[model samples]
Target: MTSTAASRPGAEHNGFTGRYLLLLVALIWPAQLLSVTGLLAGNAQSQIAVHFHTTQIAWFVLVSSLIGAFLTPFVMRAADLFGKRRVMIVLTVLGVIGDLVSALAPNFAVLLLGRGVAGFYAPIAALVFAIARDVFPPRLVGPASGLIGGGVGLVALFGPFLSGWLLDGHGWRSAMWFLAAASAASLVLLMTVVPESPVRQERTPMDWAGGLLLGGGVSAIVYGVGRGSDWGWSSAGFLASVIGGAVAIIAFVVVEGRVAHPLYELSMLSRRRVWSVFLATALLAGTVLSAGTISQLLGLMPKIPAVSDGLGFSATKLAWIGAPASVVIILTAVATGWLARRVDSRYLLATAALFAAVGYGLTAHFHHTVPQLMTVGIVSAIGLGMIVALVPVMVIEVVSPAEQARANGLQNMLQGTLLTVVTQLFFVMMARDGRVVQGTQFYLDAGFTNAFRLAAGFAVAGLLAVALVPKLKRLEEAETGEAAR
Candidate 1:
């Protein structure tokens, strides 16, 4: 006979139940929407540049991506120490406040500050993954996590179109206003529906030194890479930032090894399989970020006056091209989760990398028409969807439940750092040798092609790393046994 609901060991906890997994997935949408607000406003580059310097456009994108990355480890640690639900609510509220700040900002600096504040929302996905592992049944974990992965793509399907509509109707600020309202609504639902995690790590003092060193190191390195083309690769500032950042990172590693209750366990890095996954994930992260950025730039770039360099599509037209790819991402992510139950995850991951490589290759060489671009996008989305759905499950399989949040956080940190570096490289490549047309404010066709090629190279690297992933049947069986007990 089936056991009664009350008989379930952890069912009585007031936390988000299995029935509410969809709500948890829904809560993540606002953050995803808010994160891409800058991308949605790509058509307004000239208008924004009129108010702020052209360089600030890059800063606007960089700040949001970097700040959230630097804060993810801390936020994940907080979620582990405090409660995931509590921390999520706080972050969501902050996201709302950030949207409002951006919406009402009188100047570019204040808007950047607002975007930086919104960066806190970046780790919400890790928190949700942790919650799914804690709250859902073992059988449901993959599907639940898949939904979280897919939800991002699902929202992307609509976000651009909606933002474009709003931008065309009102103004650039209208998108921010929409983000604020959406974030507020999501915040309310999160508070009312999601329950606090029952599990909490014992409180430990915050690792201020580690945080500072790591943040400074990452920031310095990213800055160097980002500005290397503009300032000259051999410039004194570039040398100082890169070299200093490297030293700081080494020191940070040494510190992590020595600290009790460290931000991340050094021993985890020693495992070949684990490290391989991390490396592969980092490459995949770079691929996704670079590809997405290139796609947006290509979509918004005006056609060359004498040459067929760009499609010169409106934001709405670009959204329609992107929307189908988003749907494919969602579907593929969900399918990957279903497949993981039967197939080895490493193969799935490797396939993901392969898809990315092919997609980027196609875009680099043959993207002249809208249909070609859309085809490439769909191909890349498949790979991205698989990576998103599988990586969390793979991490969970390898680590104990207690360490899941930190593991995911560390994964995010690595991915974010790599993405920052890769994005800088993309900017450098695109901006090389007067790639931007004077006064037209659009990139040369070669810029987009070179960036896409770079993305393909990263995907190839990811494939190599994924190939090193040890077969996890033994590990999976062991975890399954432990869960059965």
Candidate 2:
């Protein structure tokens, strides 16, 4: 697929019917909904803590992410070997099971296990991207990718409000049942409507060692970071986990370089554009996740006497305020897909970084009222929408069709890993020496303020990464000219 050939509109070779594409999008929607529901439900942290114990709430929220980060690479490879459809069915089944377990759990440990099972759904985005690239015509690729990427943000827009309403009216377990039913519906749709992709590679030896090392390493590091504040940062266990994780990662890299059929291609990281995007992705993931966690905390904070102290809004009201930003995310993502055809992607990324930086910076300083917070969210979401739309497309642009699934899978892994660490750090920042306010049942305003400032710094770092991405014109020209020949 040459750039010119891929970019040409209405070229019908290997194109999917509209219904096929719609079914694929439909199958993807539930996965997106499940992921966002967890984030939105973070607003109920206080309630969850009361039920499960304060020490376990963070684990409950992060367990799914941690499992997802480890499992993504293996799942992508499975799709490559067995089939995308088969893998998706397996994932959906696991999601349904997880949701049921979560809804019925009597203890925090059971809920944690259930959440881990739910992690199977997290990497569906990468598989969806691969399916789009394989089945859709080049012309439709951008739009398809946009929908896959933006779909999450779109659902996430309403996710908070929906979760809030359920929490307020039906309780948290009802939210679990809702997700379970959604997953089951998606499973039915996938089996009945979605077609198997024609793309397949010869079965190769699975990289079990690579998978274990990477997964274990990432889990260790995340656990260390998550528990550091509670265990004392300088404790032996914290130092051991962090160091062991670093060593394991180094070994994984070395082993990958030596393996014939490695789980992930380490060489891809050597490419300037590829590695730059990965870095930017890590920073973007960290910033976005941190900001979101902080926003939830802020929403849950009690209305204090001082205006600058807290908003004191109910979960439902907070959802309504933040809901508009989700709409903005969908709109901006669609626009981003359209814009990528005309504009340089590097320029698009740089602009996105700027929007994020400005949004976070302003929010850090001016979060005194609902309107102000909503405005900040909208601006940040615009940038987030662009990032969500463009990153996967750019990743596709850099790799061949056969490599798309793994590349996207690796991207998800990196994003999840960084997001986990960043979110844990934010929790640490918010919890450090903090007391629960009597009426608010949340942390002081100072913790949120500090966390937002740190989030802005991550955005600034992403800006620098985007700045380093070389101009895309030459690469585009080379791809087009290659096809012409």
Candidate 3:
């Protein structure tokens, strides 16, 4: 009788789509505001330069990511300590203040500080996924993960367009204010509608030393890569920063291997499946950042005077061209969750990566036409869409529910770190000539095509990683055993 009742189809067996929808609705604006910061920051680079003021946009991205990397693990643990609801509320409040500062800052330095402080909400990435895991049943974890992850795409859809409009009309200040309002709304909705996730009782010390070494290492590497173009790849400063960062990371691994209450368990990382998933994540992150770079370049690169192959697109048109990518991502993200249940996720991953690879390959080849760019945009977007939705689900499946929040933080941290590095690479390569390419003109340069080629290569590498994922089943089983302890 107990077994029969447990197996019965009811709320216990099914999932809460309504709850998921409510959370998604609540998150859309906050997530959008957070993400649009980069777009606005990047757009302001040229504007700042025009007024005889200059600062590398790469620095802003680096600082922003570093703030998140250092704070995420600690913040998630705080969610456990003080309660996820309480911590989320505090973080959202801080984010609003940061946004307001960015909007009103009179100088670039103040703006950078504001942006970094606002970035404290970076842990919100893990908090959202953790909530999804808590609310949904086992069967619906994938879709729930997808909905939470895809919420970013919802924000991306309008963020780029809105950012461009604001930049054109009211300057970057308007966009910053827009995000501030969005953040305020998210805080209210979360307070009024969302409840704390049920707690798991445990006594674990926060890993302070590990966080410092690992966070510092990642920040150094990201900073080096981002500044490499400005300082030159061979410069002493760049090389030292990169090497120093690498050493810090090596130390972190050694310390984590020995720590009783490690921020991230070294044993878990050694599991073949977890590492394979991490590898795919790094590549996918690189691809996503690279694609964004390509899109920005497309807008900046000029038309091929008499030829029709190259575009001389305005920032607004560029946003329109890129908007399809976000749209396709939304559709695929929603559908991929259902597909994961029936199909081997590894197989689906391989196939999706192939789509992205083909799209990027086509993009590299068809440097001339808008229609061709749009079609390829859809292709890669579909693959990227699958990635953002599925990667975290894979992590949850590979680990236990108790480890979900920390693991989610690690996955996000890894992706953010990779994205920071990739964006830095983009900036450095663009700055090599010491002259910024203006208005669709860089597409005519060889660097633009090379960047696309590099993005395709990462997608191809991801496909290869996906092919090897099933081989890690033993690792997954072993991880489950550990989590059980």
Q: Top TM-score: which candidate number?
A: 2
Q: lDDT of all the models against the reference?
A: 0.72, 0.74, 0.68
**What's the best-to-worst order under lDDT?**
2, 1, 3
lDDT of 2 at 292: 80
What are the per-residue Cα lDDT tens digits for candidate 2 across 192-293? 866665566677899998888888888889889888887889999999999998888898999898999888887888888777777776678557755787
Better of 1 and 3 by lDDT: 1
Model 1 lDDT tens row, 66-104: 777667767887888888778888988888888888889
Candidates in order, TM-scores: namely 0.89, 0.90, 0.86
Greater TM-score among 1 and 3 belongs to 1
lDDT of 3 at 61: 51
- Name the TM-score of candidate 1: 0.89
Report clash pairs, candidate 3: 229-428, 300-439, 300-440, 300-441, 301-440, 301-441, 301-442, 302-440, 302-441, 309-368
Q: Per-residue alpha-carbon lDDT of model 3 for 365-389, expressed as tens digits?
A: 7755677777778888888788777
Instruction: Decide which is better by lDDT, 1 or 2.
Output: 2
